[model samples]
Target: MHFTRPRDLVVAGLVALAFVYVAFKFAYGSMPRLPTLAGATLIVLAVIEALLAFSIRARIRQRRVTSALAVVRAVALAKASSMLGALMLGAWLGVLAALLPRVGDLAAATGDVRSALVGTPSAIVLIAAGLWLEYCCRTPEGGDRKHDDHPTG
Candidate 1:
């Protein structure tokens, strides 16, 4: 598969943001208070991906015989994580947009605002880590070559 495109991520995020904003607008009052640290889970994933990127890059640069399957798996993880991050970023932005004006009027909105603030940066970090991992997966020859190391392909 080709590299994940920024345009695709942006479109996905915008679509998710619009959908979430409308839905939350009607249901927010009935919803329970959001956990401030729930979004922070994404940050853990970002850290893992970043570590993987560093390890993979080191292996590639040292001309070690990295496994083709492992590299492909990393690429797949990176692609999925990036897409997830975009959607999450959109969702958090939607929450922020919906709750910001009401923060002064509602007590819960204030806490939810904190949640959104935490989530936005967590999602951004995930996206960055995913992109870095994807970049690290590229071959020394600039990734133009397919998985020539693969036994079957």
Candidate 2:
């Protein structure tokens, strides 16, 4: 499978943002506040993944421990999670954009916008962590001759 691209994730997020914003603009429905607890949970997940990435990389390089299958699985999971985070961030940004203008006019819009602001950064942190994980999963130099050790940006 191809590696995850930053452009792809940005496009996905932009699309979601537009779709969500349009829906909110038309007042078809409103999204609930993003939970602070969910943000905390995501932060924890990012920390764990970041630590795992470093640990796995060290193990594979030192030859003290190695598991190609495990690394592959981790890479897959990282890609998926990063993409998901990007998608959610775009949606949250869109929601905030849509709500900011209406916050003063509408009583509840303020709270919704506030939550979106909070959640957007949290999602960004998750994306960064996932990308780091993907980077760590790359094979060390000499492991792959067809391509260098550097990962696809």
Candidate 3:
């Protein structure tokens, strides 16, 4: 199913807004041991990517050029966004991985294996969510490939 430009824009806007809100909350809220700095950085990057994706989608809808320029641009933006998302996910996972060992140590000290395992899902979920978002942003519309194959008259 094809999504309209307005719908894409709305979705991107909402995503960006949500990220901005989360970043703000992370930066200002009082949460002990929270990955506030990393969260804020990831949110900011996501906001930029969502906006770029929205812009590329808008340009593609215009159909002003039939030389596959729009497709190329969209693909480039999507790749960039995907890379950033991956980087953010990796950084988040790294933080969690680092903390996990410490938590494991604490857990061992207290004989609490469950507590150590509890945070494992946090990393897993973060990676999964990042992959989902990357997939969503990277999946180009069907027409994009057709445009790439067609010669510009």
Candidate 4:
């Protein structure tokens, strides 16, 4: 789960590459509306995912939490991030499904479906990378804890 790990870095790199590729494809109209929508949703999700990953990294670097309360705060933040991610993903897919068929051009429709299928794996990769980053940030090391000291005392 460590962000510094080679596997994690590879995954992150792959996800980033896929994001760029999909973005470019969508922009040039190589991707249809449905896939484009999915890609767009994935892009947004990726951003959130990256932020969560960064937060995890920060938490780990800060290592300022040994108590149950700190654990609770971390868990709560992780849960909220997860919930938001899941909801957004669901909504994105739902919206895409609802709108895709209504648009004309069967070929374009098929293209969108294909893009979604291809892009989904990449999206999953991105999510996993983000989660991994979060895991990395939650360290057991006590050295990083500084906020535990009350400044006013």
| Candidate No. with top TM-score | 1
Whichever of 3 and 4 has more lDDT, that candidate is 4
Candidate 2 lDDT score at position 106: 80
Error of 1 at 122 (Å): 0.5
Residue 90, candidate 1: C-alpha displacement in angstroms: 0.4
| Residue-level error in angstroms, candidate 2, position 2 | 2.6
The lDDT values for all models are 0.91, 0.79, 0.42, 0.49
* Model 2 spans > 4 angstroms off: 28-37, 142-153
Clashes of each: 0, 0, 0, 3
Please give the lDDT score for candidate 4.
Answer: 0.49
- The TM-score obtained by model 3 is 0.39
- lDDT against true structure, model 2: 0.79
Predicted model with the maximum lDDT? 1
Q: Write the per-residue lDDT of candidate 2 for residues 1-153, one digit (tens) a residue.
A: 556778989998999899888978887244555454455466777888899889987887787555678989999989987998888888888888888998889877876777777778888988998998987776677444344435556
For TM-score, candidate 1 versus 2, the one ahead is 1
Distance (Å) between predicted and true CA of 121, model 2?
A: 0.9
Range of the 10 consecutive residues with the lowest summed lDDT in candidate 3: 107-116
Off by over 4 Å in 1: 145-153
- Model 1 Cα lDDT, one tens digit per residue, 65-106: 458899899999999999999999999999999989988998
- The alpha-carbon lDDT assigned to residue 105 of candidate 3 equals 45
Give the lDDT of residue 153 in candidate 4: 28
Clashing pairs in model 3, backbone N/Cα/C closer than 3 A? none
